[model samples]
Target chain A: MILTVTPNAALDVTWTVDRLVPRASHRVDQVRERAGGKGINVSRVLASLGHATAVTGLAGGPTGRLIRADLRAAGLRDELVPVSGDSRRTLTVVSREDGDATVLNPAGPRIGPAEWDAFTAHYARLARGADVVVLSGSLPPGLGPGTYAELVRTAAAAGARTVVDTSGPPLLAALDARPDVVKPNAAELAAVTGHDDAHRAAAELRERGAGAVVASLGPDGLLAHTPDGVWRAVPPRPLSGNPTGAGDACVAALAAGLAAGAPWHRTLCEAVALSAAAVVAPVAGDVDASVHRRFRTTVTLVPLEEPDAPHVH
Target chain B: MILTVTPNAALDVTWTVDRLVPRASHRVDQVRERAGGKGINVSRVLASLGHATAVTGLAGGPTGRLIRADLRAAGLRDELVPVSGDSRRTLTVVSREDGDATVLNPAGPRIGPAEWDAFTAHYARLARGADVVVLSGSLPPGLGPGTYAELVRTAAAAGARTVVDTSGPPLLAALDARPDVVKPNAAELAAVTGHDDAHRAAAELRERGAGAVVASLGPDGLLAHTPDGVWRAVPPRPLSGNPTGAGDACVAALAAGLAAGAPWHRTLCEAVALSAAAVVAPVAGDVDASVHRRFRTTVTLVPLEEPDAPHVH
Candidate 1:
C-alpha cells in the first residue's frame, strides 16, 4: 500500500466557458469538481491503477468535508486530520473555444502548531504499514520548509521508500532527508539548482542526498539519474490534450515501480508512457488506458554513458 | 418581525488583490466569505438593526452547511429547507488599486419540483407570525417565473405584508399577486417596463396591482408610488464606497418600516438613509451607525404631486 500526503489539499473546480474575458461576467456552461492536490492526485492515479493507496492530510470546513466525501465515494481510503480553517478551492477556467486552462489557486488554509502536531501523529500511525510514502504539494501556511524533511525521515526510519515532489525552499530543504526519489519538473529543477541543464541539476540534487532524481521535461520527456544508471525516455510522439496532471502521473508510475521493485530502466519507460497518456486526458491524474497501452511499447528508453555527459558536475 | 426568503442563497466570497490582469495569475491579499443573496442580505441588516428576522430558503450540501453556520454565528434565526444539490457560490474580486469590484455570479443549484414544494411548505409555516415577507434575488433553475407570485399570495393569505425585489418576468409576474411593495433598481425597471423614467415606470407597476413601487435611482436616491402618495427621497450628497449591498439595505429598511406600520414617506426616507450608509460600508448589509444617523436626518424626502410627473402612464 502507498501512503500519500497532501498538506494543502484543495477542492478543484473547473468552469467551462465559451471564452474568457477579463473584468467581464461569464456564463459558465459547465462546472466540474474533484478532490485535488499533488499527493492527492498521485493517490488518485495509484488507486485507479488498482493500487491500494491511503491518503492522509489536513482538511477542514465545508470544502474539506466535500473532499472527504469525494474520496469516500471514489472508494479511496483516507485519514484526513481536521483543522480549524476552511480548506482552499482551486478554480480553473477552461476556454471551450481553444481549450486553454487558466488557473486561480488559493494559498490554502493556515495550519496551527497544534494542527501540525496532530497531522504528524496521525501520519506516523498511518505510515507504519505503508510500502512507500509520497509527500507532495505546497505546505500550508505556518508549516516550515523542513516539514517534508522531517516526514521523509520518519518514513525512512520505518523502512519505507519516500518520494518528494515539491518546489522552492521546501524542495531544497527536503533533499537533506535523502528521500528515495525526488521528482522535479525542468522549471523547478532550474529554479532550485541555478542550472539550466537537467542532468547537471539532477546531479546536484542527488549530491544533496536524493537517492534518484527524475526530471520531467514537459514535451521533451523524462530524464532520470539513478544509482544503477542514468536514462532518458520519450514518447513515440507528442500527445496534446491537457498537461495539468502529466507530471503527477509520472510520479505515480515511479512510485508504483518502486513498490513493485521493478528495474530502473523499465520504471523509466512506464513513467514516460503513463505521463504521455495523461496528457491525452481532460482531467489531471487520469490517463486513457488505451493510450497508455499503445505508448508502453512505443516509448523508448536510452541509457546515457557517464563520460558523454558534458554538463555533469 | 420580518421573514426573508432566498431560494437562491449563495456563499459569497471576496478576494482582494492589488490589481487585476486578465489571463494572468494574481496573488490575492485577502479573502472574506459570508452567506449572501438579496433576501439574506436584507435579513442580515434587519438583524443588525435589532429587528427579529427569520430566514427561510432552500439550502443543501456543504456550501449550504457553511451558510447556515455563518448565520448561526451571527445570531440570526433561520430554518433553511434541505435539498439534494449543493448551493452555489458567488465570487467578487475587489481590486484594491482602484477599489473596483468585479463579480461572478452562478445561476445556483437547480431546485427540483419536490424541493420547491418542500420550501413552500416551510415558508408558509414561517410566514404565519411574520409581519412582512420579503422575496428577493433570482429564481433558481426548475422554478417558474410565478414562484415569487405564489409566495406573495401565500404571504398575503397569512395576513403578512409582501415585498418583492427582483426583475424581468418574475417581477412582472409577482406584481399581479398584489404584493404590498415591489422594488426595482433603474436598470431592472428599464428592462421590465421599457421606460427610463422611474416615476412613470413605478406608477405603471403600481397600476398593475403592486400596492407600492419603490424604485432605486442609483445616486438619485429612492422614488416611490404608493396608495398613500408619491414620494422621492435623496441623500444630502452622493455617498459611495462599495454599492454591493446598498439595495439590500434599502429592502431591510422597507421591511422594518412595513413591520412597524410607519408612514410610506417616512419609510422612503429611512430606506434612502440606510442605503446611503450601506454604500459607505465595505460589506453588504453592514452600515456605519453614525453615518446612518447623520443621513437619516439630512436625507430630504419630498412629496411629488401626481400632476408634476410629466411621463405619467
Candidate 2:
C-alpha cells in the first residue's frame, strides 16, 4: 500500500457568497468542509483510482477530531499522532458570480520535539510495510528543515520508493536523502534552484540526488526527467474549473505509476490526464470520473532526447 | 446568577488579512477564534465583570466541542445539551489596513424535537436558581418562531426575570410572554412596530405586556420605557470602533443590574456606558476595562417627559 504523510493537515472550509464585497457582511450561500493537506489530497486521489493507500500525519484538538472524522467517513486508512496544539483551518471563499476562489491559510499547530519523536517512530514502522511512501506539504512549526530529509532517509532504509512534493528549503534538504521522485511546480522549481526554466530546475534537483523530477507546468501539463528518458505530456485541451488540487492529483498518479512498475511514458500520460480532469472538479483533491476517462484517451506524451526543449501537438 | 441561553451558538473564527480583494488569495496575517452567540456574548461580559453566570444551549460535533472547551478554559459555568447535527461556524474577516470586518454567519445546527425537549428541560432546572434569564439570538432549524416565547414563558413561570434579545417575529412573540425586558436595536424596533421612532417602538412593546422595553439606539445609547419612567442615556461623546457586540454588552449590563435588583435609571446608565466601552474594543463580547470605567463617569442620562419627543444630547 502507498503511504502519504501530511505534517500540517487542516480542516478546509469553503464558503460560497453571491459576491465578495470587501469589509461587508455576507450571508453565505453555502458552506463545504473537508479534510485537506497536500498528502491527504494525494491519498484521496489514489484511493479514487482504486489504489490501496494509507495516510499518516499529526493532528490535535477539535479541528483534528473533525479531520479524523472526515477521513474515517471517507474510508481512508489513517494513523495520525496526537499533538497538544489545535490544528489549523484553511478558508476558501468562492464567489458564486464568477466562481473565483480566494484562499486564507493559517500556519498549522506546532509540533513539539516529543511529538516529532513519536511521529518518526510510528512512521518507521509504517514505512516497512509501505510499497511507496509520499511526503507532501509544509512542515508544521517546531520542526527543523531537515524533518522531511530524516523521513525520506527512513523510508529509503525500509526499501520503499519515496516521492516528496514540497518547496524551498525543505525540498532542497530532502534531496540529499535521494528520494525516488520529487515533484515541484514551475514557481517552486524556480524558487528552489533560481532557474526560471522548468528543465534546468529539474536537472538541478536531479544533480542533488533526486532519482527523477516531475515538474508540473499548470495548464501546460507535466514535464519529466526520469532514468529511462525525458518526457513531456499535455492534455488534449485546457480544462477550466478549480485547479486547487490538480498538482496533488498528478503526484498521486506518479506515485501509483511507480508502485505498479509502469513504464515512464504511460505514467506521464496518466499524470497529465488525471490532472486535467481534476481542474474541472468543483473542489480540490477530487476529479470528475467521466472527465478522467475521456482525457486518458486524449492526452499526448512525447519522448524527448534533451530536457531543454518544448514540443506541443 | 444570570442564566444565558443561546439556541444558535457558534464557534466564531476571525481572520486578519492585509487587504480584502474579491476573487484573490489572501495570506492571513493572524487568526482568532472564540465561542460566540448573542447570549454567550452576554455571559462572557458578565463573567468579566465578576458576575456569576451560567450558559446553557444545544451543541454538537467538533465545533461544539471547541466551544465547550473554550467555555471551560474561561471558567464559565455551562450546561450544553448534545445534539445530532454539528454546530456551525461564523467567519469574520478583518482587514488590517482599514480595520473593517466582513462577517459570514451560517444557520447553526438543526435541533431535533428530542434535542429541543432536552434543552428546555435542562434550562428549566437551571432557571429555578437564576435571578435573571436571558433568551438571545436566532433559533436554529427544526424549531418554530414561538421557541423564544416558550423559553420566556418558562423563565417567567420559575419567577426569574426574563430578558429576550431577538428580532422580527421572535421578539414580537416573546413580548406576549411578558418578559421583564426586551432589548431591540433601532432597526429591529422599526421592523417590529413599524415606528421609525425608538421611543414609539419601545412604548408599543411595553403596551403589548412587556414589563420594560430597552431599545438600543446605536451610537445614541439606549431609550428605556419602564413602569417607573422613561429614560434615555447617551455617552459624553460618540465612541467609534467596532460596534458588532456593543448591543450584547448592553444586555449583559441589563442582566447584571436585574440580578442585583438595581434601580431602573442606574441599570440604563450602566448599560449605556458598558455598550459604549464595547464599541471601542477590538472584539465582540469584550470591553476595554479602562474605557468602561471612563464611560461610567461620563455617560449622560435624561429622564424623558414623553415617549414621542426627540432628544439628541
Best by DockQ: 2
lDDT by residue for model 1 over B209-231, one digit each (tens)? 89989999887798888888888
Error of model 2, residue B261, in angstroms: 3.6
Clashing pairs in 1: none
Q: Predicted candidate 2: what Cα RMSD to the true structure?
A: 2.7
Give each model a TM-score. 0.92, 0.93
Candidate 2 segments whose C-alpha is farther than 4 A from its true place: A303-313, B305-313
- The true-versus-predicted C-alpha distance at residue A210 of model 1, in Å, is 1.5
Q: What residue pairs are clashing in model 2? A: none
* Residue range B109-204, candidate 2, lDDT tens digits: 778888898888999999999999998998888888888889888998898999999999989888888899999999999999997877877889
Provide the overall lDDT of each model, using Cα atoms, as 2-decimal numbers: 0.87, 0.88
Q: Residue A238 in model 2: shift from native, Å?
A: 0.3
